[model samples]
Target: MTSISTTSSPATPTTVASAASKRVADRIAARAGDPDITLRERVALRTSDAEVTYAELSERAQKTAAELSALGVGAGDIVGVRLPSGPGAVAAMLACWHVGAAFLPMDASAPDAHRDHLLSRSAARAVIDGDGPRSLTDAAPSATGSPKGDDAYVIYTSGSTGTPKGVLVGQDAFAEHTTAIADLLELRDTDTVLQFAGLGFDVAQEEIWPTLAVGGTVAFLDSKDRALGPAELARRVRELNVSVLQLPTSYWRLLCAQMRGTESPGLSFDGVRTVVIGGEAAGTKDVHAHRDGPLGHCTLVNGYGPTETVVTCTAFVLRAHEPLPPTAGLPIGGPVGERRLYVLGADRRPAAGDSPGELWVGGSPLAEGYLNDPQRTAERFHADPFGSASGARMYRTGDLVRRHRDGTLEFLGRLDNQVKVRGYRIELDEVERHLTDTRGVTAAAAVALDDGTGTGGRILAAALAVTAGGPTAEEIREDLRGRLPSHLVPGLIRVRDALPLTTSGKIDRKAVAAVLADEHTAGEEAGAGVRVRADADAASAGIAAADTADADLTLLLKLIRTLLRAPDFGPDDDFLAHGGDSLVALRVSGTLREHGLRLRPSDLLTAQDARAAAVRMERS
Candidate 1:
């Protein structure tokens, strides 16, 4: 799946703003060449029951916008949007855009703790919900005409560093980048774009505005239906005649699974134009391969971008036989029209050709800064060393990239405390945040170590002291399950007597990694550890053999060790005295699944300890 690009080749694209509205909308109108056009595209949505039109979408967006205004939502006010993807989420986004308000989208599926942190951190004037936030304010003056920069909104990332930080994107930034996307992709009014990515995800920016701005139609797929598998997705695409499809690499894998020779096994993009794969690298191998099959007539572009920049900093189309070089893809093409990019080195020196450097994004599309957190803003958004003659500020991407011998750019790797897991960038602090939230926890710390994934080992937590009724390792994990996405959660939760800190008072990550290495090595007495004649317990032994009795004893031992989180606890350990939690019990059950074992995530939590849990597992 190594498909990240090194540099952006596209120059920034800009368009003259109309007398009213916002920059993104303005750019779309100009490119569309038809202000009178009611819908962005000419596609119709169909299903077993009925057919839908863009007019319906317009009515809903307009209605929602009007409703929001009555609720005191004005241009520029930070609105924390945490909701699922569907017609409601789509309408809310367009409604926000229609009135020229900035958008701040958060993943609705995240844990409550994460959501609470985001809302508080962003200090959003208002938070949008289909059911409305628990609190509300009186109506404010309704904006009648165009929106200004001060009125624009910004979306915040689920701060993996500890809390969420808002990325302030305004009307101008949206317009600047999208206009180039339209030109680069040749998006037209006849195209129907499917909005599959979560509003919290950047792919929405690429999927939503480009189509709507061009007077093209946008279709919001229901999340429920979205999980129905690829065959069903093909039906929706063909029925809607979706011309432009943009999806995250995760979703692409599922979609690709259902696809057959150059086309979907049961369907084809008869009217589709382009298929966009972005957010994360779409493995160069997949891109090069899928370019021709069912994609027959469609153009396939593997794009790249980071959270700090506008939607996309760069992109490259996969051409037959002329695939991207091994380093990554070509640079984002010449400022698609209004924006520009600079590859700066460690000292912020603009790197020469093929020279690696930090990616600094500048131009009119830049964000003002992080919401509420000035220190972070100062660190990331630096002054224009070239001078403020252009009033241009650049965001340090922390991504190592370089220019190609040609004009294209290539991605190197990360230079900071960030790493991507299952396509999501995670900060070690975010993991610590969730751990500290657990009861009985005094101080928690995490570190990324050597793991199979290229990003590094990842943030694993260790609690130094336990508060009265302090949480167990499993409790911390379960807590995170509700606040962060699964991928952001650590693969292992190590309970320690205490965390090690440096002279500077920061968590000693090195000390934590050492613990992790010891834990994995000590616990893994891998292979056939015991002679189990029965198919019973293999939990404690970390050993599995074909013989039933041999596996049973091993499973029992493994379950006890896992539930206890005590390296020396052994198979005879008393689960309760060992401090077992529900999550640890669940792990015991999950391990069974690896060898065809299944117990509920709460299995161990209900039991007193390993022996009892083993009894339950054996019974089940």
Candidate 2:
């Protein structure tokens, strides 16, 4: 049993079992799911269309278990739970553990191939919401259930090679991690947490179980609500009385920016007590944005962890009234729960408090390892040299970190090809593999860069080498459209005669970035259109009128170029196809307001690109 060094306590301590000794299903049942225990007659889950009480949810989970049992899903079997993030999905996941089966959670937004591959890789005994023996939501119960501390879930992540790798997480580890997070978050029965993350993401587990463990309500945002801008989301939070929220760093930034400029009617984060920001390096710019906005009064917590190490290993809490830390980046804070943080130097010895080195995690939160891949498991998870405890293992996290004298950890960049784009961890090698898979592609490399689009932010740019007269950039993009998710699609694809290589004969990512930057600069200089001015007033007040287009329309085109961050797209090109989404539309709305224009996200959604959007805006 380990204690987190936090002094905050909302309730008396209970006799919680150590992760090594108990099953997660049993712990969840005793702590939250079982109606006979702390679970009183109260709303456990809620969506826009429906609400379920704790008792009803428990019954649904039991029914789901019976359905799985009917499908022959028993001990040691893997069941794929594919559903949108809702009460039904949560019940299905619990049902897997109820029947002693490992669950594979897939994102509803994931491409068909990705979902198929995961189900095929796991050799899933039964699939939910797909072509499977039985649906988890279809059936009442016999109470025949079993729980184990073995494999609980398999999460697929981008691999260094072509295909994705599945990471196997055990029930005990997940239980300990979520419980520890709940304790750290000081979750109570009064708290209402919004289920913000996608169903497949590991953080969803943190959002769900912790609230349930404390008998708190879990509020869910429907797809329409999810697609709404920051103002709308904040309004929902206020209306629902959502006290806790976990948002990705990128979306949080967008929200902070939205609140900084305008005051939406009855829209504010006044009720949100704790906001945990993770999935990517929480930008300092966003911190400044929030500090000056409506969300300034809420508690901002910066959490850091990879998929390999459960949801979160360290947390840095930023009080609204406190001055920002003097550190270059937000401190990742110290170890949580039964976890130990070791910054090992080149010699595999512990680095000094101020020195930068590879960070290793040794803890109960450690996953079982990559599913069906022992070689990678052996490479990353090794015997903990610094630990005094025998049989202890440490994961060789390729991230570099520095520990301050005050026992706080600061995150440095990654040591490998892995990069997080809008909180999605992507291995550049995997993108390259996909690029090369395209017809006539000889060599390919992908890099994340700060393309000039203010709304879209950092985008995945790629450089490709192909045979003479090979597929065009648009053609390749169209080909990849069906194979990959929108986030994985490259915003800019520059065809090269051959990809540059280093002296060691490896793909030169830096050179590729330089080439893209140079080409972008050249394109901006050569293209004849309304050039965006540095001053917001000049750009939005009105750009120089073209002979062919109106002055306002020219200004609108410039706005589109600046907002979308794509210089290559024509007036007819689809905005979304060029990496623009509803979140980006929010930014566009904010920017438009600064220079005496008004446009809503819904209005912007009606148009396809620059010409259409501009026309629609004018007519409106």
Tell me the tens digit of each residue's lDDT in model 2 across 1-620: 11223211211122124553455456445544454554545778988767787777778788888988887678777788888888878888889888887788888877788787777776677777744336333221211122342677888788898778888887777877777788788899889999988888888888998788677889998765435566568777876679998898788888786678556565577788888988777656678888887777788888888888887888888788777777757777777677878888888898875899998888667888887688999999998765555467789889999877667788888998888888888898888899999999999989887655453356688999999989987788878877776667786788889999999998888999888877665654543243634234234434445532355455555666655545545556776666566666777766665655656665666576666676655321
lDDT of 1 by residue, 58-165 (tens): 566678778767766666555567777655665566677665565567777666676666666555556678675322343222221223524345666646467767
lDDT of 2 at 31: 44
The clash tally of candidate 2 reads 1
Off by over 4 Å in 1: 1-52, 98-100, 132-135, 138-151, 158-161, 225-236, 250-264, 267-273, 281-283, 286-298, 328-336, 387-389, 448-469, 485-487, 499-506, 514-620
RMSD in order of candidates? 7.7, 5.5
Local error of candidate 1 at residue 491 (angstroms):
3.8
Model 2: residue 514 alpha-carbon error in angstroms: 1.2
TM-score of each: 0.72, 0.87
